[model samples]
Structures are given as structure tokens and as C-alpha cells.
Target: MLAGIVSAVLAALVFGGVAAPAQADPLPQLATIGSTLYSFGDASLCAGAIDLALEAAPHHPGHVLAHVTPRGYLGGPCGNQVKLGWVGSAGLQTRDVYVYADAAPGETITTDLWVGTGPAKVMAIAWPIRSTFAEWYLLVP
Candidate 1:
């Protein structure tokens, strides 16, 4: 369940989706803002959309750009509850952020959300740290 949310966040920023609609710019295949709906169209044209949304406000919507989850690890960057947040410091708007790993409960993750770049390949960073154990997640751009 957690992994799904992280993937949804990952889908938002990666560049690879359908075509843009005739009326508006290439719509996002599945976009949102703090549970608020946005848009979606061709799966290709809007590939870089999620990245754009996160670029606008990575914290508001709680899109963890810390790291990419491993091939099979689906544990998202959240606790058992539904509250959303990040593991490291705040995200830098306008820059490219990379998903490092899964931010588990009480974990520490670090991601670079560049402060001047356009919508590109920002990833979902997830860093889950335990007393002596640690985990991570990285997104694909």
C-alpha cells in the first residue's frame, strides 16, 4: 500500500507518458495536489508532469523524493498511518530531486531537489533508517 503511494508520486515527476490533449498542454496521466485532482492525458507527453507538480510544492502534497524502492520492496515512505512527509530537509524548488530510498518510520533520507532546473527527472527519495539497519528507495527518470 505504501509502495503504491510512492510509485504514484514517482509517476508524477518521471518523463515518459502519453500525448498532450488538443485543448491544453500534454495532460498528466495522473496528477494531483494534496489529494486534489489535476489532469491526465497521453501517457507519453506528460511524462515530465509529476516532476513539475513536485517542483511546485514537494511538501504540500508529500511526494517523497528521497530514493527509489528496490525491485520488489513496496513499503512506501510513510508509517502505518496515512500522514505524509519526508525524511530529510525540505525540497528545493526549480531543481532536480532524486528519489534515494523508502523513508520508513523514524528513518533518515536525503534527496537533491535542485533549485533552478525545469521539470525533468526528479525521483522519489525514500530513506528508512533503524538503530543498526537501514533501507533506501530510488526513482527512475
Candidate 2:
């Protein structure tokens, strides 16, 4: 009976009757500048918040920012309802800053960031409340 059940399951999968598990999309490539490594992608964190993470050299000091761009019609204005913030190691976090999207689809809204102490692992989160489509980049300078 076990063999029969296994065979049935295999047949269902082979015949496309059973749906395969969805694969998570790959994160964006990381960029390096003078020793800092920065990257951004869609992150599914706790409480349904999609966030981005940045890893920098430990013991070094640097600054970061979020360049958020909203997706929409070619000539229409994009939404201006995103919350930008960063969380660092040792439970350090910066206050959230609200930013509005630019009128152009590719135009970006820049949010300045203050990262915590070094050997640091920081996560920059961009939560869009009113926008349907958006992309963000965590930049180090």
C-alpha cells in the first residue's frame, strides 16, 4: 500500500497535477566601494515587511542611504508613501523617515542613513504602504 501511494504521488508530480514549490527570487548583486559592500533586494522579514540588508567591513565607519524608485505608468506620478529606516547590530536602529516617490518612474527618493558601530551588519528596510511596485538600493558612501 505504501508503494502504491508513492507511485501515485510520483505520477501526479510527473503529469503536472501537483504544483511544485515556488522558488525565491535571487537577491540583487552587491557593489563594493573602497571596502564597503552594499546590496539590496526584496526581503521577506517578520510581520510581512519586505526589507534590504547591507554588510560592511567591521570596525570601519561609513554612511548609507536608500534610493527608492516606484513603478507606475510612464507619464504618471509615483506614490510617496514609503518608510525608510535601518537596523544595526546590538539592537541599534535609526528612526523611520517618510519619503515620497518621484514623478518619473525611474526617478528616486533618497533617504540619508546613519549606520551604527563597525564590524556591523545593518538592514535597511523600505516599506511601501501605498505603492504597488517599488525598488530600493542601499548605498554606502
Candidate 3:
């Protein structure tokens, strides 16, 4: 009789009585908006964008330049000259910045602008020849 009771208890524990703990979905590693790619560092602000960024760079290198922007604003010309500077090295480095606005949950929008190697220069081609570029993340909040 005792053996039968012990077996029933064991079966209940192994089969279905206790509920498994719920876990949140893993954070994403990459995000892409148009031709641009966004790579995130360990201290990334948003989780969803991280996944998108990773998708953009599956086998990314150690040093990369990421530009994040909204969906419709990519075609616009630079308002002023922006210049960024950075030292190139062989170590792995990531720079993540929020562009435009904070990404709300379930809000799907093109938030990544572009990714590149080395510094970026944004030049405005006009009468006087205005040029701009900068190091680090561009158009970030």
C-alpha cells in the first residue's frame, strides 16, 4: 500500500502537477532600417532593436559604425555638417544610441539608419559646399 502511494506521488511530480516557471523572451541582437544597420553593445537600451541589429550583421567585425533613423527620414539631406572621430582597433567595440524617439513596445517602425566602418561624414551639397560627419552614433537621442 505504501509503495503504491509513493509511486503515485512520484508520477504526479514527474508528469504534470507542478507548473513550469514562465520566462520572458530573449532580447534581440540586431535591427535594420532600409540599407542601414544598427549594432548594439552590452548596454543596449532597447531589446527589440537589438534583435533587428543582430539580423543586420550576422558575422559582424569588431569595429563598426551604426546609424539609426526613422523609416521616412533617410532620404533627407543633412541640415548641417556633422563630423565624428574614433580610433580604430582590433578589439570588439559597440556603440548603441536611440534615434528619433524611444521605441515603444509593439510599435514597429524603421528605427535604424546605416552602418559603416570608420567615421561618418555628412556633407550638404549646396552653394558654399557644406560638409558634415561625426564619430559615434548619429542622430541619436
Task: Give the number of the best model, judged by TM-score.
Answer: 2
Model 2, global lDDT: 0.38
Point out the higher-scoring one by TM-score: 1 or 2: 2
**lDDT at 13, model 1:** 59
TM-score ranking, best first: 2, 3, 1
TM-score for each of the candidates: 0.17, 0.35, 0.20
* Candidate 2: regions farther than 4 A off: 1-60, 73-76, 89-91, 94-106, 119-141
- Higher-TM-score candidate of 2 and 3: 2
TM-score of 2: 0.35
Per residue, candidate 2 scores C-alpha lDDT tens digits across 22-94 of 4322323243322111122123211211222333322344544444444332323323334444444334555
> Model 2: clashing residue pairs?
58-119, 59-119
- State the C-alpha lDDT per candidate: 0.27, 0.38, 0.29
